[model samples]
Target: MSSDLGRAMPIERPDPLALLEQQEAQRLPWLLPLRHSRMAENPFAFFRGAAVVMASDLARQPHSGLMVQLCGDAHLLNFGFYGSPERQLLFDINDFDETHPGPFEWDLQRLAASMVLAARSLGLSEKQQSRVARRTVCAYGKAMAEFAAMSLMLMWSAQLPMKDLIDQRPSANLRSYLAKVTAAAQSHDSRQAVRKLCEPDASGTLRFRHQPPLIWRLDQLDEIWLGGLDWHTWMQESYQTYLADMSPNMQHLLSEFVCTDTAIKVVGVGSVGTHCPILLFRGKHPDDMLVLQGKGAELSVLAQYVDLPVPEHQGQRVVQGQRLLQRASDIFLGWYTNPKGQHLYVRQFHDWKASVDVGKIDADGLRDYGILCGWTLAHAHARSGDRRAIAAHIDEPEVFARGVLEQALELAELAEQDHALLLRGIASGRISST
Candidate 1:
C-alpha cells in the first residue's frame, strides 16, 4: 500500500543567499553581520540560525497532512527548562517566535535534523548519530500512542519534571553535569537575572550595565524617538497597554510595581535583529524587581507555505501558540502592538529559566536527551493535534523510526553543504560578516 509517511516530494530549492537577503531586508542592518558571524561558527550553529531556510525546503516536501500548532523552529537547543506559574521546573519547547499551525511532521523533521547535526558536531560516528535519530523517532511514536489513550484531564495535567530528566541520566558524569545545571537553573530567578544584568547607579537607582552592541539602555541611543516624549513616560504608556491584557488579579499584582528602567537586549541567533527590549520594574521594595522582555514578533516562515489565516497581530499569534503548546507558560505572557505598528509579545525574563549545556553531553547523554526532546514534542503535538491520527500514521514504530532516521541523515548532509556555502559566501564578501 502507498504510504503518506516519509514520501519524497519535488523541491525547487531557492537560492540560499537570496532567501537570506530577503530575510535580512526585514531585519536591522547592523545586526545582520552578527547573525552571519554566529551562523558561520559550525554546521550545528548554522542549523540553529537557518530555520527559514529549512522551512523553505520543508514547504516543498509531501506532508502526512497531519496538522498541529507547530514549534516552527523546533531544534535541540529550543527545548529547555523553565518555571511554571506554581514554581515547578518543567522541560518543554521554550522558544515559539515562529510558531503556527503547520504539518506536525515539520517539527519532527526540524528536531530530527538538529540531532544529526549536533551529533556530527560532537564527532559522533554515523552509526551513533543514526542511533540517536532512531531513538528520538521511536520515543515520539511511543509518546503519541500513549497520549492517544490518555484521558483529556490527565494529558492536560502532564509535565516532564526537570528532576526526573536528571535522574534518567545514563552515566555518572552526565548525572553530575545535569545536577549542576539544575542547581544553576533553580537559582536563576528574577533577582539573579537583575543582579547579573543591572547595577546600582551613582544615584542609587538600578540601571542596566552597558554591554556594547549586545545590550544598551534606551537613553544611550543617538536619538530619543518615543513620540517626542521622555523614556519614562513612554514606558508607562506601554505598560498600561500591556496591563490591559492581564487578568484582574494579575493587573492588581502588577499595579504594585513601578517602571524603573528599560534597555535593548539582543537575543538568540534567529531573533538577533528583532526589537527586544527588557523592561525593569521595582515593586514595593528595592530588592523586589521584575524584568520583563518585550520581543518583536513577525509572520511565521511556515505561513507562506500553508493556507492559514493571516494573524491580525503576529504577537497575539505567538502568545496563543505558546499557550496551546506548553503545559505551563510564563504567568505574565501577553502581547500588544507598539505605536510604530510593530507587534511585540511580553513575558517575564529568565524567571528560573535554564537550558542544558549541549556541549557537555556525551554521545550517550545526547541520545538520552534526544529521547526527552522527542517525547516533549510529542506531548505538545498531542495537545493540539489529533493524537489518534498521529499514532495511526506512525504505525509499525520501527519502520517509521528507520524512515525518519534515514531522512535525518540526508538532511544533515544537506545542512553541512549549506553551511559550507554560507562560509564561502562570507569569505567572498557575498554575505557580509562585518
Candidate 2:
C-alpha cells in the first residue's frame, strides 16, 4: 500500500535550489546563466531541466521495484520522430542522458507529470489536463498488458508505426497537425542543417557559423579557455576513437568523407551547460556532406539512488542504453574520451530528428499524443523488463490510472513551487539569471 502511486510523494525533500546549484557546479560555469534563463521561462521548462530534482525526490519515496532501462528523463517533449538506419521514419524516446536501469514507474510518473505541465502550458483547462495525464497511464497499462501476452522476440522487435497511428486519428485537425510535424521532421536532415548552421569562410571553406556563447569555433575561444592544448590534435584523436567502435561497414562508409569543421554547439534545456560539439564532414562530391554531434555524458541522475554497478565509461553506458531502448538507434552512435578525459557519445546530427511542439496541441491532440508516448514507453520497457510482472502489478488500468494521475497532479504542484523558488533565488542573487 505504501507503494500506491497516489501516496508516493516524499514527506521531506532537499531544497530544490541547493540541489540545482549542486548540479550546476558540475556544468560549464559560463553556461549556468543560460540554463537558469531557460528554466525560468516556464514551470514545464523547469521540469525539463530538473531531472536531478525528480530523481532525488523519487528516491525518497517508495517505488514498484519493477526495473527497466529508463529513458532517465522521460518527459513528454523527449519523445520524437527520427529516421531509422534503413531510412524508415520511427517514433520513440529521444533523450537518454539520465538513462539507467530503474523502476518502470519512475518513467511513467515523469511522463504523466510532463503531460500535466505541458497541457497547462497549452492553456488546457484543469479537467483537460487531468484527462491527458490519466490517458497516458491508462494507455501504458493496456500496452504493457498486450506486450505481456506476446512472445519475447515479438515484443522485442515491435515498433510503433507513428504515421499509421496519426492517420487513424478521428480528428482532422489533429491529423493535419501530425502531418505537418512528420513533413517537417522529414526535412530536418544534414542538408537542412547546413543551410541554417554553415557559412563559407574567406578561403571558401564551409564551416559552422560563429555564434558567440551558443556556437563557436575552437579558435574563437580565448587562450584561457583553450588551456594550451591543441584542439586539432584532440579532434583527430577523439574522432578516431569514436570510429573504432563503429561497425566496419559504417567506418568504411564514413572514411569517404573528411572532417572539415567542428564547433562548440549548445543545445536543450537540461543539457545547456554540458559539452556538445557539432562536426562537419565533406566527401569528394561537392554536395555530399554529413554532420555529427557529440554530447558529454555524466553519470545517470538515477546513479545515486540505484545500487547497480557503475559503468567504467559513461559514454559507453549512454550508447548502450540508447541501442537497447530505441527500436532503431542512430547508425553512427558511438563514444569517445575527450582530451580532458571526459566521456562523450556521438550520433548523426539532425538526421530527420524532430519533436512535437507540446505548446501547440489542443486537448484532443494532447490526449492522442500522450497515448502514443505511453505505448512507446511500454514497448521499450517490455523489451528490457518483465512485461508480465508489470502488467499484473498494474492490473486494474482504471484504478492505476487514477492513482498515477493523482501523483502527477501533486508533482505538478511541487514543480510550480520549485519554479517559484528558482525565481526567488534569481532575484535574491543566489541563482544566476542572465
Candidate 3:
C-alpha cells in the first residue's frame, strides 16, 4: 500500500535447497506427500512430492499490494470460522503464523489453486468447478467492499462463531454433523480431557489420553521432531508475550488457570510434522482451566516473493500478527524464544474453536460457504489497513469472479505442472521422500 509493490518488490524466488536449510520452519514434509501423489503425476509420484517447487514458483510471482499479512500455507482447507474477541458470529481467514506482507495475489493464487483441487476431488466437471471458483471470487469482491465500509471496531467485533456458522445453515446434513462435532468439542472440556486424557488409568498418573485427529500425548511423535529443551523455553517466551497482550484480569485468570509448564501432543494438516506442544494451566478448578497450545512457527513463505523484512524469530511473528490482525484475540496468546533457540507461538487451543466443512456440503452449500469465506477474508484484509482503494478496485463480484475462475484454472494447471517437475526431481534423487 505504501509503495507500488508490484514493480518495487523483487521477484527473485528462493532456491528450494536454500529454503530447506532454515530451521524447523523450513522443513515441510506434508508438501512432500502431495508432490508424490499419483493423481497429479506418476513418473515419480506426483502430488505426494511437490511443495518446495510450488512455493518456489509462488515466491517468484509479481507483487500485487502490501495490505497483505502472513497467510500460512493457505488453501481451501485452511479457511474456516472461529470465535472472535467479540461474541458476534462472522467468518474470516483464520491462520496467520506464516503471514507476510507480500503480493496480495500470493494469497489469492494459493486459495484459488486449493479450491480447484478441492472441486476436482469432489468429482465435479471442469465447468462446474470453475463456477465454484467464480462464486468464491465474487463473494470475496463483495466482502472486500463491505469491509471497506466498516470501522475497526465493527470489523473486530464480527466473528463466525461455531454455533452461528453451523446453526444458521439450513441443511440437515451439515446440522447433524455440526451437532455431533459440537457435542464432542464441548464435552471434551479441559476438566473432562484432564479427567480422561490426562488422568492415567491403571497407572494412576495424569497423562494424555490419545484422541485421534484431535489430541495426542507428546510421546507419539518421533524424537527428532518434538525433541529438545528448546520447546520448553519457547513455551515460556510465548507465555510472556501472551501476558503482555492480555488485559490484567484475563492475564491473572490465565495465570491461575494454566499450569504453564508442560508439553502435550498437538496436530494439524499443514503443520503435521512440526513440534507443537500443549501447555496446561489449571486454575481455581480443572473445569475453570485453559489449554495453551505452543505450536511451532515457520518462516513466511512470502519471504520467497518479497524482501518483507520481518522479525527474525518466528514466535514473535505469530504473537505480533495475532495482536495486529485480531481485535478480540485469545487472552493467553503469546510467544517465546527457548534456551535451545527455538520459537513457539502460545495461545488457548480451544476458545469455542469450530470450522465449516465445505468438503461434505452439497454443491449449493459449498457455493454459499465459499462466498462466506471469501467475504470474511476480504473483511479481514480490509481491517488490517485502508481497504477502500482495494474495494474500489473491484466493487462487484462479476469481474473478480471471472478473473478468479481464470486464475484458478491457470493455477491448477501450474500445480499439476510443478507436481510433475517434482516427481522428476525425486526420481533423479534431487528431492527426498518423507
Candidate 4:
C-alpha cells in the first residue's frame, strides 16, 4: 500500500446538487423527476445513483497504480446472481455500465463504501457497519492472495454457484434465506417475464402491457419521445447490427426468433431516464418467447479521470469489459448503435437475475453477503488484471482492510452529507423530485 493508502484526498469538493443537475441534463427530460425521487428515497439509494460524485472524489486520491478492468460503480447491489449461458446460477458482479480499465483499488473502495452505507440503511449499529466494511475489504485481499497462488487456468475457471455458496454457509437461517433467493431467481425466465409484463392484444398477438412512465408501447408514446425515428426501421436495422456483432452460433440460434414488439422500459436508479428498450420475440411456436433488453451506454464515469483509451462505441466497451470480468457471460450479449446515434448494448432480460435486498437483511447476513461480494470482486479483478501484483501490494489483509475501511467510512459520511444536500435541494425546489 502507498504511504497515503487510506489518507483523505486533498481536493476541493463540488456542490453535489450542481453535479447531479449537470448529469441529469443529458438524460431524458420527463424522467428526471423519477430519477431524483428514486435517489432521494435514502442515502443508500442516493449513493447508488451518485457514482459520478464518487468518481470525482476518487480522482484526487493516491492509488496503488495497478490497473484492472474496474466495475466503475461496484456497489453491493451490483453484485448478484444471474444465469450463465450454461444455465448455471452463478454469483458475480452483474452490472458493467460504468466498467473501464482503472486502478484495482477504485473498485474495492466503492464496494467497501457501499457496504457501510448499506449497513447503515438497514439500521445496523456503527460497530456492525465497521465490521461489515472491514470484512469486505479483508475478504477481497484474502481472495486475491488465494487467486495469486492458483494456476492461471484454475483462477480463470473459478466460479461461485448459488448452490455451492448456500452449502458453505454455517448458519441455517442464512442458508435458508439464500435457498429462497436461489429458487426465486431460477423462476425469473422469459416465461415469467411474459406472464408479468406481456399480454395478448386485440389481434391475439403477444405485446408488452402498457405501464405508463415505466413501460410504454411504441404507439402509446408521443412523437417527441420517439425523436422522429421510425420504430419499425430502427428495430430492423438495430437488430441486424446486433446480430452481426454476436457469435455465429448465437446468431444462428437467434435467427429462429423474430422480433414481435418493443417498448420503452425505464429501469435502475442510475440508468433511469436513459433510452432503454425491451424487445419481445417469438420462435417457431407461439409459446416459444424471448425477451431482450437494450440499455443505452455512455462513456464510463471513470473515463474522464483515468488515463485510459476511450472506446469509440460505449456499448462495445460494456460488452467487452463484461466478457473479460465475468466467469460466464450471457451468450446474447452484443452492441449496436441506435437510430439516434447513441450506443446501446443488448442482452437477455430477467433471465434468473436476482439480488439480495441489503436493506432487509440483518447485520450477520450483511457481513456474510459482503464477504461473498468481496471474494467475487477479487475473482473479477484477478481475471482482468495482475492477481500476483495486487496480492503482493495487499500483503497484509488486516492492514489493507483498516486502510480501506478508513476511506470507506469517510466516504459513507460524505455520501450522507450529499444525501442531505439532495433533500434540501428538493425542499427548496432547486432539484425536482416526485
The candidate maximizing lDDT is 4
lDDT of each: 0.84, 0.87, 0.58, 0.88
TM-score for each of the candidates: 0.95, 0.96, 0.76, 0.96
Q: Which stretches of candidate 2 lie over 4 Å from their true place?
A: 1-11, 223-227
Residue-wise lDDT of candidate 4 within 1-434, one digit each (tens)? 24332333457888777877777777887788899999999999999999989988887777888989999999999988899887989888999999998899899999999999998888889999999999999999999999999999999998766667998876566677888898899999888898899999999988999997889787777656556766777788778888888888888899999998999898999998888899999999867889999999987878777767757899999999999999998888999987668899998898799999775567888898888999999999999999999999999999999999999998999999999999999899988878
Q: Report the lDDT tens digits of candidate 2 across residue range 52-85.
A: 9988877776678788888899999999989998
RMSD of each: 2.8, 2.6, 5.2, 2.6
Residue 146, model 4: lDDT of: 97
Q: Please write out the lDDT profile of model 3 over residues 409-431, one tens digit for every residue.
A: 87677666655655566677765
Give the 10-residue window scoring lowest on summed lDDT in candidate 3: 41-50
Q: Candidates 2 and 4: which is better by lDDT?
A: 4
Q: What is the lDDT of residue 125 in candidate 2?
A: 92
Ranked by lDDT from best down, the candidates are 4, 2, 1, 3
Task: For model 4, give the 10-residue run with minimal summed lDDT.
Answer: 1-10
